[model samples]
Target: MYKYLFFLTASAVPGAALAQDSTEDALAEILAAQDATGPAEQPADNGGEQITIADQLVPSITVTANGLGTDIRNTGQAVTVIDREELVSIQGADPTRALQRVPGVSFSRNGPAGAFTGVNLRGAGSEQVLVLIDGVPVADPSSPAGGFDFGSLLTGTVSKIDVLRGSNSTIWGSDAIGGVIDISTRADTGMQGSLELGSRGTAFASALAGVSEDDFYVGLTGSWYETDGFSSAASGTEEDGFSQIAVGVTAFYDIADSLELSGHLNMSEGLLDIDGFPAPNFTLADTAETQKTLRYWGDIGLTYYGADLTLRARYSRADTDRSNRADTGTLSFESKGQMERADLRGEYRLVGGLSAAFGYDYQRNQYETSFDSFAQANIQGAYVQLGWVLGKLAVHAGGRIDDHDFFGSETSFGGDVSYGLKDDWRLRASFGEGFKAPSLFQLFSDYGNRDLQPELSTSFDLGIEKGQRGTGTHFALSGFRRDSEDLIDFVFCTGLLPSPCSPGQFGTYDNTERARAQGIEAEAGIDVVGTLRISGVYSFVDAEDRMTGLELARRPRHFGTLFADWEAGFGLSLGADLRIVGDSFNDAGNFTQIDGYELLDLRAAMPFGDNLEVFGRVENVFDIEYETVSGYGTAGRGVFAGVRAQM
Candidate 1:
C-alpha cells in the first residue's frame, strides 16, 4: 500500500505543476484582457460603485464596503482604502495606531480594552466614528448609557479597512456623525495563507485560505500576537504588557446563476495591563487589569434580478477584571464587569438605479463593580437609506431614529449629491445632522444626575474627484463645520473632588453647549510606475468651542501623512511613511499642552520562497519624542523583524 501511495503521489506531481502554470497563465490573460478593455467598457464602472465610495470590484483597489465597482476617484466622496500590506507594516497591538496615517483620523487609548478608547474624525467626537464589520454594526454593550469602548476590538482579525470621511450619514446613521470605518475580512480566493514570528517579544501568525469556484468560495483566517513591551518602565516592561488572539471565516455561495449569498464570523480576546497608582507617565506598580472580549457577526443575504440584497446580525461581549494592591498596604480588591450587544439589519437595491436599505437594532448593557454598583441600560433604533442615479447625477439620502429609555428619542439625517463635470471629473457636496447620546458615565458617574440629553450637531462637506488616462490621481479637498448642542461639559466642580485640584470635567449631557470643528482634508493617490502607490493626506482643523473661546483638548490644528509603497520583483515590497501632528491643547484647563511632533516609519519584505518571506520594520525612525495623551510619553524607537511562512 505504501509503495502504491508513493507512486500515485509522484504521478500526480506533474498534473499539479501543470495546474499551477495554467492558473498563472489564466490570471495573466485576465489582467491583460482588463487592460485591453479599459474601465469605460465595464458596466459597473459606468454605474454606481465608481461613484459611491471606492472601486469595490477592481482587483487593483477592490473593496466590498463601498458596494460598487468604481474606484474611489469615481465615488466623488472623500474616502481612503488601507489594504492588508499597510496593516501589517505599522506593527501595533491595536489597529488604532495605524489609523494615525489617515488624514482626519485620531484616537485616544485608556488602558487598552478595559476603559474607553476614543476615535474621532473631522472634529466629531470618538462616538461619532461609526464602526462596522463587514457592513454590520457592533453595538456597545458596556456603556452605562451609550458609549463605545474602542479598544475592545482586536485588529488582527481584519483583512482590510475602508475609511469614508465627513458626513457618511446618508449611507450610514447613528455613530456616523464623524464618518464610517468599515472593516472586512479577506475572502478566500484560491488557497493562500501566512505565518510569522518576530522580536520585541513578539509572536505573530495569520492565515487566509479557501477554495473559489465559478459560483462559490470559502475562506478561513486566524491570528495571534504576544508582546512584552517596547518600554523600559515597569508597566511597559515584560509581564506587564498586551496580548491578542483573533479568528474568522467567510463563505460565499451562489444559490442561483446570478444570485450570491455570503456571511462571515469573527471573534477576539485582548489583554492589557493598566497600573492606576503610578503617576501619569509612570508604569503601574499596583492595580493591574485583564480584559477579554468576544464579538461575532453573521449575515445571510442574496443578489438577483439586477439588484443586491443582504441581511446582517452581530453579537459582542466584553469583560474586564482588575486586581489592585494599595501601595500604602491597605487592601487589594478585584473589580469585575461585562458588556454585550445584539443587532440585525438588511439592505436591498430595487428597479432602476434606486436602492433602499433598512434594519432594526437592539442593544443592551450590564456591568457590576466591587464598589457595590450594578447598572443596566437598553436602546433600540431603526434606519433606512435610499440612493438614486439619473444621467450624470447621483443622490443618496438616509435617516436613523433611536429610542433610548434613558435619553429619550433622537433622530439623524444625511444626504449627498454628485454630478459629472466633464472628462472623468465629478463634483460632490454633502450635508447631515449628526449626534452622540451621552455616555452612562457622563450621565451618572461618581455622583451625577440621570437627566442628560443627547448631543446633537449639524455637519457640511464638499469635495471633487477626477480620473484621467495617464497620471491618474484620486484627489479630494473637503471641509466640514459641525455645530454641537447640549454638549456635555466636564468641570472640576469644587464639591465633587477629593482635593482642591480641578476635577476632570466630562461632558454635560444637559449643558452640551456649542462647539465647532471645521477642517480641510485632501488626499491624493497617484499611480506611479508599475504598481507604485504614492499617497498623501493633509488636514487642518480648528476645533474650538465658539461659546468658551477655547480649543478642544487632544485635537490638532494640523496633521498629515505622506507614504509610498513599491512592489518589487519576486514578491518583494518596500514602504516608507511619515506622520505629523501639530501642537494641541492637552486639557480644558488650557495650562498643559501636548507639543506637536513628527515621526517616520519604514518597512521591507523579501520573499524567500513562494510561501515564505522575511520582513523588517522600524517605527519612529527619527526617535521623535511625542505623546498623543498629555503627561504620558510614548516609545522613542522600536524595531521589529520577522519571518513569515505559508502554503
Candidate 2:
C-alpha cells in the first residue's frame, strides 16, 4: 500500500530532475583531509564542545553556480556564507546589516527599522540580484522593478545565508545579473527560544521547536518584533513605529530507502508608520501614515537518490500584499503580487570525476494594483551544466534558454575554472552572461512599454586565495568587471512631436541606458590567539553610466569593514565591528553628494549554564549621524539585550 502511494505521488508531478543533493559529501571530504594532517579538535568557549579544524573554516556544502552541490573552494565565483552562529554574534535585526560586511556589496536604507532597504552587489541594482528563501524566489512582482525588499526580512528564523556574487543567469535564469542570495531556515531537531528588549520601546520574542527520528522530521518557528522608532524623514519630529509577526514550518518524510518527501511554509505580516514628502516643496513631512504588508511562501518537493544519480521535483509559490492608509482613515494605495514556479532537476555522476546536471523551470507572475486591473506573465526555461574534476583542476560550464510571453526568447552561458597551485593556494576565474526580462509593471502598467527589450549583461572575475586549514588563516583577492547594455529606465513623455507624448504625466519604461562596473575585492581573516580572531574586507568599485560617463547613484566607490572578537574565560565573549563607506552621489547626474561615514558597534555575551545565555550589543556606538539615502533618518546610538534558552 505504501509503495503504491509513493508511486502515485511521484507520477502525479511532472517528471524532471531537480538537483537537490546535499553538500554533506563534499564537506566530509574536506573534513577528512583536514583530519589527516591537523591536530585534535579543541573545546568551544560556551559548552566545551569539540571544534575541529574544518569547523574553524566554517566548512559547509554549497550549490555551485552551475546548480551542482560542491565545496565552496571548488567554485570560482565569489561567495560568502553566514551561519546561524555568526548571525547571533552580529546582533543585527536583519541579514542586510551582516551582508554589508561582505566585499563588493553595498546597502541603502530609506529610514530606520522596517523601512525600505536595498542591496547592491558589485554595483548592480537590487533588481539584478535574486533573493531566495528556502530555494524559492521571493521578489514582489508588484514592486516597480520587481526587487526583493530587505526591510521585510528578520533573522529570527533564518539558519544560513549564502551570498553569491556575479552573474549566474546560466542556471538561475533571469534577474541574476548581480548575483543570488539564498536564505535557508533551521531544520535541526530540538527546541530553542529567545527574548530581547532594547531601547525605544522595542521587544522581540522567538521560539523554535522540532523533532527528528531516522525516517521523518518536523520543525516549526515563530517570532514577533515591535519597535517605537524615530521618524523616517531626517528632519521630522514625529515618531514612526513598526511591528511584525512571522511563522514557519518544515517537514520531511522518507517514503523509502531511496525516496524522500519534504514541504515548507512561511509567512510574515508587518505594519509600519511611514512619512512622505509633501508636494510643492518636496521636503520631509512630519505627518504620519500607515502601511501594512503580508508575505507568504511555500514549497513541496520529492527527491530520489540512486547510487550514482539524483532526481528532484518541486513546486513553490510566493505571494505579497501591501496597503497604505492615510491619517484620515482613507485607503491611499494598495497592491498585490504573486509568483508560482515548478522545477524538475537531476544530476548524475558519469565517468571518473565527471558530473552532469539538467533542469526545467516554469514560472508565472501576476500583479494587481488599486489603479490597474490585473497583469500576468509566464516564462519557461531549460538548462544543462557539466563539471569535470581532476587532480588539481576543476572546470564547470552551463547554458540556459528561456522563453518569455512578451520578450520572446533569451539565452545565456557561463563557465568557471579553478586550479590548485599548492597545498593551500588556489587560482580561479569565471565569466558569465545575464538577462532580465521587463517586469509586468514595466510592460503593462500606466508607465509600461511593451516594446522594451530585455536588459543584457556580461561579467567576468578572477581571484586567488590562500587558506591555512589548521592555523585559521585565510586571504583572498578578486577583481571583477560587468558590462550592461540596453538597460531599462523610465523617461518622461513631454507631449512633443514625433514621440509618444503624454505631457505632464508619469513616464514610460524604456531600454535606454548602458552601464559598466569594475572593482577589486580583498578579504582576510586570522586567529590571533587561542580565543581571539580578526577579519577585514575591502572593496573598490568604479561603477558608471557609459553614455554620460557619470558614476552610478548610491554606490560607494570605497567600502570596507573590520571586525575583532575575543573569547575570555568563564564563557564570556567580546566583539567589535567597524564599517567605512566612501562618499557617493545621490542622483544619476551626480548633482547631490552624500558624505562618507564610519560606524562602530560593540557586543558581549556570557553563558550562565549549559542551556542559558545572555547577550547584549551597542549599535552606532558614537551616534554618528549618517544616511545611506538622502532625506532619510538613521538609527542613533541604541542598546539591545537578549536572553536565550536551548533544550
Taken over the whole model, the C-alpha lDDT of each candidate is 0.55, 0.76
Q: Per-residue lDDT of 1-647 in model 1, one digit per residue for the tens?
A: 00000000000000000000010111111111011122222232343221211122233332221233333433445566666666766554456666776778876554322234677788776666666555344444234333445554445545556677765443344456666776655553445544444444666555556665555556666666666543322234434455666666666565654344555554555555444546785544444443333333343333332325544344434344433445454435444344444555444557555656565666655554444366665667777767666566666677878887787888777766777776767787777776665555554556344666666778777877665311467666677677777776654545543332223544223454678899888777788898687878788988887777898888888888888888876677888888888888878656788788888888888887676677888878888867777534365567777665555
Residue-by-residue lDDT tens digits, candidate 2, 1-647: 01100111000000000001111211211111111111112112334332322242333545535565556666777888777788888875666768876888898887778888888999999888877666567778887888767875778776666788898899888898988776666655589988999988888887888776656667788888889989889999888888888887777777876677877777778888888867788677766778888877777778776555677787888777888888776998898888999988877667766778788989999999998779999999998888777766778888999999988999999999878786578898999999888888889887787777899999999999888311388899999999999999988776534443244446787888999999899999999988999999999999999989999999999999999889988889999999999999999999999999999999999999999999999989999999899988989999999999999
Model 2 Cα RMSD, 1 decimal: 6.9
Which candidate has the top score in lDDT? 2
User: Residue 286 lDDT in model 2?
Assistant: 65
